[model samples]
Target: MATFQKGILGGFSGKVGNVVGARWRGKNVMRSLPQRGSYTATAKQEEQRLKFKTVIGFLSPLVDILNRYFGSPQGDKSRANLATSYHLKNAVVNLPTGTVMDYAKVLISKGDLRGIDGGTVAAAAAQTLNFGWQDNSGQGKATATDELMVVVYAPELNLFYTNVAVATRDATTASVTLPNFMASLEVEVWASFSKPETNFAAISTYMGAVTVL
Candidate 1:
């Protein structure tokens, strides 16, 4: 049985005979029920599935942040969707071992805002990560008040340490202290800048990988 919110003329949600109706991306959608059978995916289909899954899983940790600053929604696609599409195409790779992310190519945010100049990161004592950049505020679309955003991922633990709005672009330097458990482990880093009051952001830069001290 299907449920309609506004009589027979309105869109429905639920199962009706062989068809399934549901809301998708805010639109009413319908599709036929899958037939009961063992199905094998083609080589291309399998590849696509692996790529999609890899991107989605790799991005799960940053979903909320990305949705907030990655980019503006285009049509029905949200900011998260745009970021996922970008990573799938440019960051995931097919190597002999398997499909995996090229962490150095990842972007935590994407937009028209101008990025910091000479951005750099280094691991420091007490599991702290230090960041520095040449202040390019007032250049192009950049602003002195643009806030810094950083993401640190420790692959061995499959965990992330995110610091948003930790400092403004004009500060030229900032720091992030991770849990003690992260000490001595290798981690990947990325950084970006966003307005303190809006969802707009600069395209993030990979700050290179480092072993925590």
Candidate 2:
């Protein structure tokens, strides 16, 4: 019977009569306290939470990088939030009976119909990294320009190198120059097709992580 307008900083705790206040999605809300006791989630629920964390850890660092090029289809938030939400939900849920979701692959594709295939990475000159991939745009979809995202982390040094490159749809390779190279580097590569008109990018293909010599 009561609807409040926006523009209020929300913080609510304890209980006021029959109504309890809480903050949700950056907004203040009131609801009746539940009668149930606290309980732990099941094994399957925990597994899904772990999946969400894994997906989030990988994508959080890439938010700035994604926003620079892909922006967002929704506009209100960065594309990274969209990618995270999509994959977190994707980790759970049953498919159409016969279908099975590949969480590993889903982490990279992130729900985009077009994904990279046969991607390979190698150390290119002194501080440059080379990446190559095959287009996985099944049928009917016209081949569009592709964008490449490369993230390199040196565990020993606790360093990260992030870079993005653009390639023609027909081109299968691109390279990025790092600020400096370590003896051994762990790298994760992703690629997505660009919809220039909409300023949106398709789901990215995770090119797998590799240690380069």
Candidate 3:
């Protein structure tokens, strides 16, 4: 491994022969490319790999939401990466068949902003979800104009239906109507709030499972 003072060929950015070069942090660097070969993973390594795949597959679709509310990035880790690390450690479970995600433990958004109070969700007419929450507008950093964010996932369908900035905190209620294709499907529901005036968000609440109308 080597760091170039003047940068090789003005900071090389690709592979040439056995060496690969790119900028890391703010400095140009070069290193030998990894040799291509087959290697066996240890039991622990394989388990970690499975957990990564499981979490990535589930969270990839929710990247926008995760990026917004998961948490601020630390050094090289982005918010999405932070979210993945968190679920990998806390939400994934190993089973006799394979590593699986526990839906109840899934977090669509995470932050220190004031969270929903007495939140609930239930099936309503026309494939809609009726969401209700007690108004907590004057509580800890909470404001009347903070908007709602909702996420619903249908695991059997492998799809997510989400709404961002849907309703104000004072509204105390909101509804989400899924596509007709989602009718009668059992879905997991979650809710959070974000202040429109700034990049602030509340940790989300999982409102339990409900069958869509």
Q: Per-residue lDDT for 1-213 in model 1, tens only?
A: 333344567887778899999887666777889899999999889888999998998899999999999889999899999999999889998888999999978999998999868988888899998999998988888988999999999888889989888999999989889899899999999999998879989989998999999
Query: What residue pairs clash in candidate 2, if any at all?
Result: none
Query: How high is the CA lDDT of each candidate model?
Result: 0.89, 0.57, 0.89
lDDT of 2 by residue, 60-128 (tens): 666665554443458566666666676567643433452233433543323333556677777765666
TM-score of each: 0.87, 0.57, 0.89
Global local distance difference test of model 2? 0.57
CA RMSD, predictions in order? 3.2, 7.3, 2.2
Among residues 3 or more apart in sequence or in different chains, the pairs in candidate 3 whose N, CA or C atoms overlap within 3 Å are none
lDDT (10s digit) by residue, model 3, range 18-64: 99988898998999988789988999999999999999999999998
Best by TM-score: 3
lDDT, candidate 3, residue 131?
A: 88
Off by over 4 Å in 1: 1-17, 20-30
